[model samples]
Target: MSLSIYSIDLAKHSFSIHGEDTNGNTLIHKTISRAKVLTFFANLPPAIVGMEACGSSHYWARELTKLGHTAKIMASKYVAPFRTGAKNDLNDAVAICVAVTRPSTRFVKIKSAEQQSILMLHRARDNWVHERTALLNQIRAVMAEFGIIAPKGRHALQANIGHVLEDAENQLPDLARAILADCYDHLLSINQRIADQERCFDMLVNHSNNAQKIMKVAGVGPITATVVIASIGKGEQFDKGRDFAAWLELVPTQYSTGGKPRLGRITKKGDKYLRTLLVHGARAAITNIGNKTDRLSLWCKGLVERRGLKRAIVALAAKNARIIWSLLRNDTEYQVAV
Candidate 1:
């Protein structure tokens, strides 16, 4: 089988492919409908195909592989520099061609159906959680204008609403109390949705071997485990533990001058949602169980004292990403050194 190189630009209704080889020689450039993309590739010899990572790109990549062609998915940002002239399908396709063949460029890993399914779960749960928070904040803010303050948390809302309403000596009028009562009911409804999603997450991570191994670390639990697993897809893409951590944006941002390197704030470069989950889990470990005397735990505990809670959580999250990367890469159990 011989290898041919081509770039593709995917759009809503149509697609374009720009074929070329090294030494700046053009081979084939044509537009095809979405329905015909697979058929067109099917006739071509087994070759290398490059496309930007976007919606449905993964599915197409899988299809291309089935047709015996190798697919390289590059981030759109990386492909932008190779684009010549206006940003249209042809130029974009050319950009992808240049980007994929670049030795220094990074490619996206192919995700299996199971990995995609788990990620769907994460997206659904995250949406529900966000909706819940938005409503909770609105409820609190609305109540504040009426001089009615619910307790600090959702649990406190029910009890606090009752207490404030029952106090005849309070300044809130009947209408304000009635409004607070309705908002509390709405807040409770959102809480129920969150609980339901959490139950779904529990069922998800419970069945996965990787998720179970990851949860063994101090800063990880069921939610964190699933998010990390889903976001990483297959761990084969990462070359090292720090590579995985850096992908999760767990590492400190880098700056160097005069051969002296300095670290600043976290790069926070990867998936924001996954990073947030890891940081949250790290916080839980530090506050509730960071002093277990294990190597990582002790290190995290000391970090909390030295760097304060927020920085400590970010640091531990980075460590946890590295540990996860190691676990997946080496296919070994996590050992807690005391």
Candidate 2:
């Protein structure tokens, strides 16, 4: 019998595949080496292929689509409930096969090569930033051990680190001074790399009309705009603005019971990096909202007074996320309320 659906549990070298016919009867279940995967799929008639979203899943999805098969990549959590046996590649593949056919399963957006490249840039920059922060903390701790204290803040550390290194009166040893000097230089290098990434983001924003359109929102800057574009092109996967906000996990978490509704804190799920950028941008907007009488600014002021500063910031971030969805999905600019 001809196979109607195929699910693959992907790995670095071996892949487990499970296939079913149109009548839901199992057709094939086996493992194939990485080299033979494409050749195997190339011979099959176009059918629905499913895989859990993970490393290299998008690349495989693109390849499968090129083979005239409809590929569906789903979050692993959605597929886990379908597994009938112990967790293994074959079982995972079977789970994927079952989950893909479910109507309510939410699938992840397939990122393009360009979008993936931009996200890689962001990841690299984020790594460097974390590394830099760690280095700074190390330097501070080492200096404190020698009874030398640099003032707080990055700028303060930058300003005093040199003097601390040069000062022979402090208890700092020659070895510790040399090590700190090297760390400071590394910090500078990481800073330069981060600046380069920002420049790349700036160029991306200039070239992408979608990024430009979303930047008109109050809480959207170049970083947030470019990230949103790279993460979701035109926001078409979501049916509405609230759906987009919910996907971002900016909405409150629900813990409702029978005939009762209860909402908790923000879910704090999904892409943490993207959520962080949105929240930081929201904080920046709120910090500078003084004396502004626009509708959004007025709303922010009232919200801050009513719900406190932190909740207001999250509310603004959620609102901005929705506005961004509307702007991108409709291919229109944000209209500022005067």
Candidate 3:
């Protein structure tokens, strides 16, 4: 049978595939074991294959592309509207099949193995940081139970924790002191791991031309630069900087009626990690923009004065996203306007 398009509902062990002909008639709908997936597709003629952007979807897409098929991955939300009946693997496969054929559907850009590896490092670092935060909070709460209070910041806690444990006159029981000591040790270990991950990011940024270029922009550090490179290689997937910013969901949400435009706060719908990094970076840039007369700096100064600090931070973040996109898309250096 001549297959025109194939949609796959991917899973750990089994995958449901829906195949259609040129006339949109369903030709094959069946579940296959993981091991046989590539073999099955390899046997068929090269065709357009679609899958939702979920865990392992990129791997499958890359594998399908290797078999001469045009692989496309769409967001799960985009595929949801195309589902006709009850939700299941087969129905999802059919929905993907239908969604892939639509011109308006936006597909995910496939990440290479190297990109995935960098992102893996990022995930590891982020996880370790969260673990450290939880450990800090737990330690503080336990200490507070015994009428002990550590200072406000992590640095203060680190500095005073040893003193707290060593002081014999405090309310902390021997057992509690031991436990708190253990917790502090664990926090130190987590901090070490996070530092190691950040060093890895630095090494990656040093090697990547794209990372280096984006890092030239204000508010973008090694972490942000490496993540952007991993997430979107050259930014070619986006037509313009504004589209890239919108993809990051840094743009405002819109609700228009009767030709009246109504815009609300940012959609905040895409990768929260990326959005957060950008915002934090923007905040840092704004804090350090002292008496600079450059065009970008002046604009940021004006924005902060006109819109207040919080909105200014977000606007600067969105602006940084656009600037990063432009640098990556054009393969050029960032120029500070006078």
Candidate 4:
């Protein structure tokens, strides 16, 4: 029996699909509307379909699955090698078709609607945080021109906002005051939007079994759990827990020759957003806010004492990612050396 493979190059409004049969022949080639992709897939013979994991790839994966096609999403990096010369939709599609049939290629696991939906909140929250930071920076830059200096940190700046606004003795011109006030208002609105998104995240994670299980580990909270789960997707895609942490770029980059290994900074390979969450979560765990003690806290505190706070946070986040993998993969609850 021979298997056929198809590759699709997607765009904003149109896409090109190229197919190659087991006999090394171009079986099909065509361009179609983005809106009509699923309909087209339903009419084609059931075969393996490959598309770059960009934009709305997951949604298409789910739809194709429903239509009985074995669709797989390959990351663009993996598909890039096959594309030679100039890049165009047709050539890209042909390259994808070529790449998918390779013996040792990796494919992204298709995420469910619930996974994507939950992830949307994290994305939305992150955007709002970025907007807030930009707004604060604009306020700071604008105020500095008038000799107004506020302390570092969001809390410090926020605490001084009222004082700055009320202090008439300060040399801030009326125009400066008006601009700062508008920026401050924008910052406040962005913060509120972020808080709202977090609430949605809380609701979604509270409803997930995996999220609850992972959260039992110290340093894993609602946000951390959401980040870890969404970033890793299905844990089975990784060979082991360490692989997941390394994918998160928490592991050190290695330079080794002839069995002598030298590790540098973390490779920083995967989702930076999730990596940041875990690091921050690790910081809180070491803070030990609840005066609660657990194996995770013990590990985090030990690292902090040995490696200092920042490095310790990174180490603990790396450790937490592995523990999360264990919990999710083995289907076990968190325990203190049980």
Candidate 5:
């Protein structure tokens, strides 16, 4: 019988696939090279296809979808439980087949080429920032060896570096000065690269209507605005604003039994980069909310007085996540609560 469903365990150069008939009987099982995957699927009757959401899974999903197959990307954890025996490509393929048929299984949203392109820019900027921080920390450690203590914080270190290098009274040797100068020069170059990446983000934000609409919320700047738009796309998968926020892991986690509910801290389960940006934006909004009578600002002050600073900042971020969902899902502008 022609297979009614299929699961693929993907690899760089090869793949393992398991197919099942409508009665849940195994119909076909085989290994094929990566080059043959699409051609094989294109010939097969259109059916449900499942794969783990890793590596090039999104790219494959998009491709398969173009071929009329309903491709579903499952997180590895969810598929792990369905493995019947020892781990192998065959077992993993079978597991994916089983997991995809389950009603409760959560699937990853397939991202477009443009979405992945935006994410590439974000990841590149992150790498440059990490390299910059490492260089700065190395400079700080080298300076400390000479018994010269620069005050804490990046701004302070930048302000004190020139003075430390210029002062002869610090008794810094020539070789040490040369090494530090090299580190400082590299640090400046990395900073310029980071600035250039931010300019790219600004250009993306200027061209995206969704980015502009979301930025109307107080805390969201260009980076946060563009990231949210890139990450969530149209937000059609989420039925409500809270569902979107929960996906971002901004909602409180729950542990309940015996008809009782015990809620714990926020789940922190979604994209770490997006969540961090939202939190940082929230903190900035909190810092700048000085005696403003607007509903958001007034609410922020009251929350600060009640739950204190950190909790209030998180609460605000969660609120912003919900608002972000509303804007993206409905394609509407943000309206302040009056």
Candidate 6:
């Protein structure tokens, strides 16, 4: 039988496949070992293949595409409602198959190996940054125990750490002093690593033309710009700037009945890391908006005055997401509104 579509529940050692023919008759249903997956698909006629967008799904999608079959990677949440029976790999595969057939189901864009590689740097840098923050907090706690206090900022801590450790009047025990010194050294090491990673990111941004274009937008820097470029590539998957902004979950959530709409907070539905970076960039831009006399800055200042700072930041972030979408979609440079 010629199958219309096949949905695969991907796993490490095996995969569950569910298939139906053009007349809506069940034709293939079973689990196959990982080594034989390609062989099984190869024997069948070219058809649409569906899988939940999870680990290894993108890689498998790429491989399936190479075999002359259409590959669709869907968000698991969208497929869950289609499950008919008890939760299991087979049932999940069936659900995926059902979901993929729906005309309105959204599929994840398959990321290339290059995109994944660039993202690795971001993940590494984020991990080290968290470690640095933890170490700083630990240092502050330990210093407070000795009746020595570090000030608010990282630079203040840097200035006071050596003095606290060397002060004889603080009566620091030998063991405690040695531990704190070791922790301080570790903190220094982490800082150096973060700096190195940032340097690498800087070089990457300088080479990427799209990243440079994104950076031109207000509030976006090397980190945010590279992330946008790496995550969306050409942004062709998004139909418009609003679609892209909604994907980032920057748009407001809505609840409506009787044609009366009530909007709430942002959906926050997408990548947490990227969303956070965008918000932080927006905050920075908002803080500086008052100092500038440009049209965009003046408009942002008006928004801040009307909506207050927090909402203003979110609005600007959502606006920037739209601007980013436009730049990527059109491959055009940003020109600040005068």
Which regions of candidate 2 deviate over 4 angstroms? 1-3
> Candidate 6: deviation at residue 197, Å?
1.1
Q: Alpha-carbon error at 128 in model 5, in Å?
A: 1.6
- Ten-residue segment with the worst summed lDDT in candidate 2? 165-174
- Model 4 has an lDDT value of 0.82
lDDT, model 4, position 309: 87
Which residue window of length 10 is worst by lDDT in model 6?
Answer: 1-10
Error of 1 at 93 (Å): 0.5
Backbone clash pairs for candidate 4 read none
TM-score of each: 0.89, 0.97, 0.97, 0.88, 0.95, 0.95
Cα lDDT of model 1 by residue, 125-155, tens digit? 7887787678778877876887766679766
Q: Model 2 over residues 204-285: C-alpha lDDT tens digits?
A: 9999988988889987888889889999998989999999888889998888889799998887687899999999999999
Q: Note each model's CA RMSD in angstroms.
A: 2.7, 1.5, 1.5, 2.7, 1.8, 1.7
Candidate 6 per-residue lDDT, tens place, 1-338, comes to 45489989999998999998888788789998999999988888789999998879879999999988999999988899999989999999999999999988998899988888889889999999999898899999988987777899997897788887788788989999999999988988998999998998899998999998889888999999888878989899999999888888888888999999998888757888998999999999988765788888998899888989999898888899999999888978888877
Per-residue lDDT over 228-256 for candidate 4, one digit per residue giving the tens place of the 0 to 100 score: 67756549888898988988889999899
TM-score of 4: 0.88
- Comparing 5 with 6 on lDDT, the higher-scoring candidate is 5
Better of 4 and 5 by TM-score: 5
Model 5 Cα lDDT, one tens digit per residue, 166-185: 89999999999988888878
